[model samples]
Target: MSLRSTMHIPAVPAFLDSVRLRDIQLPLPAAPDPWHRLGKPQPCTASLKLSYSSAIAAAEKDDVSLSIDYGKLFRRLETDVREMAQHTSSPEHPHHRMVSVEGTRREEMKASAVGQDPRVTAGIVANCGLSLLDETAAGVRRMSHLRQSPRNSFSGSQAPPAPQPADAGPAPITAEYGRCEVWLQLPKALLRAEEGLKYRSVTVWGYNDEAGADALESESRSPVVLEEEFRIEGIRCYCILGVNSHERVEKQAVIISLGFEGPGQLAWGSTVVDTYVALTRAVAEKVDETTFQTVEALATFVARIVTVDFGNERVTVRVEKPSALPFVQRSGVEVTRTQAFFQSHEVAHSTLATRGEARSIEVLVGPASSLTLFRCPKQAALYPLEEPFIVQR
Candidate 1:
């Protein structure tokens, strides 16, 4: 995709506070290490600063339910980190004493160490943090720091050396211990308000209560989106996509762009290129079967196909109608959809019917400044009552 043609939004605001965990232990993989044959997990220290937010009311009331659960997050991180250590080998590990090896032995050693790769452990942070963010009371937060201990070599004849920084000058090949450190700062906006609210009756440790509605509004007005993206660009199609009389009678030339983000790797033996081809075909087929009065509808249709038919975790679809106006080169509409969006949409529609409340419900997506109403069917299966009445996408 051409960089010039893509849309860019600079700096998505992240409203949050931070929790710090220093010097926690990590485990090693269970497999016998080619280097550390001792087969026992080593203990290491880890420092992490987790950025999160609690409701202004909850923070004031000292409600743990509305706050991030430090104990739970710690246990999860501990298990993941230790498993990575156990299955992997390091030059400093007890088993990896020799400096040189050749042929099958070298290959076997590398293969055995695959799970121990730094990237593997890094993924623990990337995959785990989002859900915690969702659980936070204010709903917009981030993880600012992630670090793991270093690996140092040790000699059998000497006492294990003291733990050293990963960036510290090279250590002895047989050194035993290393240290991990991570630091992240919460967004200043949240901190500023937190500092203002102090009450003699209650001690609010991590957040403030003084700003009141303004603070809550500011926090709710800006949300942080952590997205991984894939794009399909410059696909040309013909559609009846406009409100004008001339546009309805004739098919107009349009350009389409799509981007997707999702968790989980592709199924084994499948490639991204393969997925793109299939997605393109599905989009083309949908366009052929439908007629739209506006670019927004066309874009929404494409987004639905990617999310529903293709099972994309999330998608952004843009449809550009060129020559709609003589003076203008082109104009388009863009729409974003996600799995959570569909689920919430279904719930909202279902809630309206069963609760016998309002005749219809309009879902507002994102922050207050830019909101889109998600359209849903009037009739559907029973929705779980446990679903929140207000669904935020």
Candidate 2:
């Protein structure tokens, strides 16, 4: 049976265009803290003996107090560094590392480290000692003059060196937010229809705080870092919009659809899905409850559908409800559907086409499900010519 040209679909609201979108998926089994997970917990104690020289050894017996919670210290340092990394700075600005250490023991250590020799300072800095090696080396050099002065007092003669220039290379991209990685396939029919069309995909990685974003961006060489650190997964999806005409001036309504894997984190998945639904609804309200949808809205929708990995070029969509499962464990549903199902619906129209033919074609390719609607008469003709065209069940 032939398909009906126009159907009464429920109206979906439009969304704010300012929303961020991403298409990359992260891996799982993130890195564990070596010090916390593997280090042996031993009681910490230290005694200080100060002598001007062996001949002048002070007769005063000195008692020193020290206590260490190695695991807590390491965790605090890790969290601090991660937070510092999240600060957004132009590649030109110097990124400051701020830390807050409380408790009497930590306070005492900080006091001892202040204006002290590099070795003493290094010991007090906790887990980030290695990362701060360069700064520590510089600090040592600055303080060296104090040891050489006639009175053995800090002279403060030299000003610190200027901050280094931001690296000239492209910023490193990492999967610092996601745990799993999934692939998506474009239906054969959609592939043929959008053979040479150009579409852009963007991924914006956000964090609980600005600091988190900075940290992830700074450490990320790709999206994989998020998976490794957070044990979260990632997926790639495409936004297939059905525009009525190619003319930039023409305003036409388009159908919007998304293709993606099952949701990753249950809370995150629900939040993303709700956001997507809201954006789609808003766009539908703005354009004809039938036509135009922003790329941002569609991208946000697909971001929530991450479930499982179907290997290379297989389409999968996921839905998660962490709170819905018994015992409140991490849980979600993954639904696998071929790209062919989505491609049949996304249609594109162009003004450049001859009366009976389409002017141009654009296809949405990725791991998620998307919609392609026909906007112009010519597009309507080209929509069905694709290989693996959809067969209405």
Among the numbered candidates, top TM-score falls to 1
Best by lDDT: 1
TM-score of 2: 0.18
Candidate 1 residue lDDT tens string, 1-393: 001111111221233455556655444333222243433443333345554332343466464554656787777676655555542445333122111111001123334343322222333432234234444532322211111212233445565556657766321111011111232111111111211111010001111133343343332111111212345566667655565434543467887777654321222101232245567766765575445555765676677667666666667788887878787887888888775776667753343234322123344433456656653212111121122232342
lDDT of 2 by residue, 1-393 (tens): 111112111121121111111221211111111122322222211111111111111122121111122344344344532332232222221211211111001112222212111111112222132223223333434544444454553445655444446652212111222111112111111211121111111111222232333454353212100110011122222222333223221333222333332322212222232233233333233222111123333322332222111111222333232333369554444444443433343331121112212233344322235445423332333333333332110
Listed per candidate, the RMSD to the true structure in angstroms reads 24.8, 24.7
Candidates in order, TM-scores: namely 0.32, 0.18
Model-by-model lDDT, in order? 0.41, 0.25
Clashes of each: 19, 64
